[model samples]
Target: MDWVRQNLGHLTRGQIFSIPTMTMIEEYVRRDNQFIAGPDQKYVCSSDDLAEFNIPQGISISTYDRSNVIKLYEHTVFRHALSYQSDSPRPDRLASVAEHKGKIVGIAGASEDSELMWQVGVDVLPEYQGLGIGKAIVGTLTKRIINEGIVPYYSTEVSNLQSRQLAISLGYKPAWIQLYAR
Candidate 1:
């Protein structure tokens, strides 16, 4: 704790999570072959700052209840956008789906992380990747979450440029970073 206080306390939040700083912390504390994980980026957008996105010409976006969301849980391809963990404190509460030609092609789901905050995740089919489906569904869900008086947040691995860009394009700002042991 003293080491963390002295070495990391003085840095700003963004600086504390930089690669060099995280590497230094890892080197200082890692024990015999243990591995470290993360540097995941967390992003959040205020209701006033949320951006608008247009639904693609051939795609339709609609909200889905929990039961409908659960039907897609077995689909590994959409794992990032939807998960049903019975014991999780943060339970998934809402999903906005994008359908093309009557087939579900993309989904944006939100988990109620806390009373005032919800975390969002998204997945778009490989064939529909370049289209605006991800942005549109996420934007729709984000606005709905905000309307319910809760903050919407998103997180992604540091290496996922597309996911980061999607969040940024929706007007989400970096709130924090996490580095943890695995």
Candidate 2:
């Protein structure tokens, strides 16, 4: 707990998600640019400009304050990658979505596992991936969590370098590594 305190900040008791407790997110991902990498941050963007940022052209993005729409994503396809549900009561979660032709092709979610730890999860459709959609949504969500004064962390399978790199590109450093049996 001491290490958590020294690195990640503390959360006062009885605190819930509220406007007063929230701080303004620095960049919510404007219409033009999606993942705006910070100064000296080489992991964030494949390119500086949105037009060249690698996302497939003619895509639309959105974010939600609730997880309701997560149910809309295909469960069979994304279930292994994303576990949270719009109606589940276990972990408190919210989501962001990227659409192509009005279909949800990508989603990024944040889950509050503990008062001080918020874990992030993301899923991009197999057909629509490799185009920077993962980084765009995840980076935006990370920034939004930072705006709320909470540090966001991630966990991915050892073989999933894409997932790991997405987090690293968003300015998250590996604090520790773990190897456990399922």
Candidate 3:
């Protein structure tokens, strides 16, 4: 659990964990932009402000409705964002789209993977990659979920460093990481 030891400070620090109902020990790590602890007490930790969550000005991001998702991504691979909505047993849904010059260039969507965790998936047009479009949409969508009191989680292939970095830049840490063959 070296990853947890090394990154626990970033996710949470200095907070006393006395909540007995916590099935997951890592859940005690809360996000406080200014979580400063006094001294090295029995239990204390900390995290740095790694990245700016806000996007550049002039780029707009907004949530889309069921019908709107199809119209927006019918021509793009992000069309998959709406696929589960039509499933017989579907997941909770929330999505945000990024636009430039009135064209949707990126989409960030969450499908509830568990009772308390919603998996985040972001897709950006090839031309828009690395311009922070993915981050903008993902950040916005994550905030929306948190506003509703749901945990937003991100998972990527171990080889996908860019995706991992983006998630970290937004303050997401490795809570439960594992690798398995398909």
Best by TM-score: 1
Between which residue pairs do clashes occur in model 3?
9-46, 13-45, 13-46, 14-44, 14-45
Show how many residue pairs clash in every candidate, following the order shown: 0, 0, 5
Q: At residue 109, give the lDDT of candidate 3.
A: 78
Query: Over 4 Å off in model 3, which ranges?
Result: 1-51, 65-76, 79-85, 88-92, 180-182
* Model 1 misplaced stretches (Cα beyond 4 Å): 10-15, 18-21, 24-34, 66-68
- Against the reference, the lDDT scores of all candidates come to 0.86, 0.58, 0.62
lDDT of 3 by residue, 21-112 (tens): 22233333333222322211111011232245777566798886444544443545784343444442445377888889888788887776
The order by descending lDDT is 1, 3, 2
Best-fitting candidate, scored by lDDT? 1
Candidate 3 RMSD to the correct structure? 13.0
- Number of colliding residue pairs in model 3: 5
Candidate 1's TM-score: 0.83
Report how far off residue 111 is in candidate 1 (Å): 1.1
Residue 150 Cα positional deviation in candidate 3, in Å, after optimal superposition: 0.6
Sort order, TM-score high to low? 1, 3, 2
